[model samples]
Target: MMKTKKLIIVGASGFAEIAHEYFDADTEYEVVAYAVEEEFLKTDTLNGLPVVAFETMHQRFAPQEHSVFVAATYTQLNRLRARLAAASKEKGYALASYISPRAFIWRNVELGEHCFIFEDNTVQPFVKVGNNVVMWSGNHIGHHSKIKDNCFISSHVVISGFCDIGENSFLGVNCTIINNIEIAKDNWIGPAVTITHNTDVAAFFKPAKHEPASVNTYRFLRIKEE
Candidate 1:
């Protein structure tokens, strides 16, 4: 078999570890090292690879030889990840995309550069996923949905058909967006929130807290004392 491209993950966090595992097992990119900011650089190695400083990573791992993947989470509404991805491109390194083999992507789906789609993501036909987008596992993206750039979708998000998710938006886990809804840019959707209609710019929707139970589970279940 031919040799695969070398990859350098620009993070050492939990998300980076997941990224490494997926890319190493499924993709043609071999993860050779990890890169982080100088101040945040704690250890010399991660996962048996050297943890290089992001400031001078290009010197050690040349852009022409190794590609980069910014394995940042949804920090600062994905602005930090977006910035790092852009910076890697500016440094002349190609950005790598990770699409899990377990994902079910329709042939008509259009995915832009630097995207990360985890396992069990069902992307329907005509779904347009923009650049620098990250979708966690088990998301059901319906047909004709348009997810714009720099969006971070958590696991189990159900986006119905004809929905448009705007840029720099963060969708938390277990959220559902109904059909034909247009989510605006910079929106922060908390877990379990359902969107049935269009939203304004920078909309923030969080689920309401439920009242605590008056009695314990044993009393509720009416179990006899042992």
Candidate 2:
């Protein structure tokens, strides 16, 4: 049996905690510690492991012996995760990727490092997912699709075949992108929005909020008020 590799997660947020659970239970990586910026290092322990300061983490866990995964969300349009992953690489730590065992990834899919693919994600054939990308649960990445680096795809997103999602883009929950569409870099597509054509760089698309009806629930249902 292959020995499980020791890993250090870079972040102290909820995402880091989730990454710990997934890495510990599903992947071959054994999460040994959590690292955060010194200012945010409030507690010394998280999930029964040492929470070290990111600035001096190398002193404790040598980069040659441990790998790192930046467990950050789509903060600053994924710039934070990208920066931390780059920093971890600069510190001589190999970036770790986590593809859930429950995800259905095709044999020809080309996935890059530092990517976190959650459960129920279906990555079709010939898909190329770049580094520092995060795909949340239940996302469908169609055949021949290319997700560029630093992209964040939220839950239940659908990207049809031959789509090219550019770098640093964030696809919100339940958003749909049609086939052959090219989503430009740094785009922010809001939840439930459907894109039929290519997007410009840094484009922001949001669905209109549903307005509440003037009639109360009791009146709309013809029921007596409590």
Candidate 3:
């Protein structure tokens, strides 16, 4: 909150483009450039910002002067973001967090470094968040929700009150978590999963069904381990 901050978006993606709107609308940070990996550097301008080589963008604007944020959306994309953060640090540039102005976050809602929160996210009171949490648009994080570190929550997720989301968990689009639920670490909650209770640690819940006569692998796969 000292000088006006400048940002370099790390991906030339639709998600990145959408994030630009939130950044522009909410924060005082000005996105002066867009950055991509050497291979994905297509056009020069994204959202009217110059496209710079992510590999060396920090040379022009030192991390002390400017900050960077990742904008990828894939489940595995967070690893790459972590790498980018390391790379940026090597260049002496710090990673940044973008919290939307339109989002309703109550006081004492803890946020860690490098968290990206988009518009329309209603984060209630007593919510605890850890580092590297990417919460996309339109999420309702109910009160007393505890989100562990390195969680990726896609758009429109409804996490009810007292939900405990574990570390490295990936909650896909439109996922719903009922109250008092404790999702264990490393669980992949596939899109539209309405979780009502505690899930086993390291579980993968994908909505699967049978085409008639074919074994319902989803149902069959639910049997307890021998």
Please write out the lDDT profile of model 3 over residues 3-91, one tens digit for every residue.
38888888888878877777777787788888888777878887677898888776666777788877766446356766766677677
- Return the lDDT, model 3, position 39: 79
Looking at model 3, the pairs that clash are 63-93
Candidate number that wins on TM-score, 1 or 3: 1
C-alpha TM-score for every candidate: 0.97, 0.97, 0.82
Go through the candidates in order and give each one's C-alpha lDDT.
0.94, 0.95, 0.83
- How many steric clashes between backbone atoms does each model show? 0, 0, 1
Candidate 2 on 97-127: residue-level lDDT in tens?
9999899999999999899999999999999
Model 2 CA deviation exceeding 4 Å by range: 1-3
How many clashes does the backbone of model 1 have? 0
Name the lDDT of candidate 2: 0.95
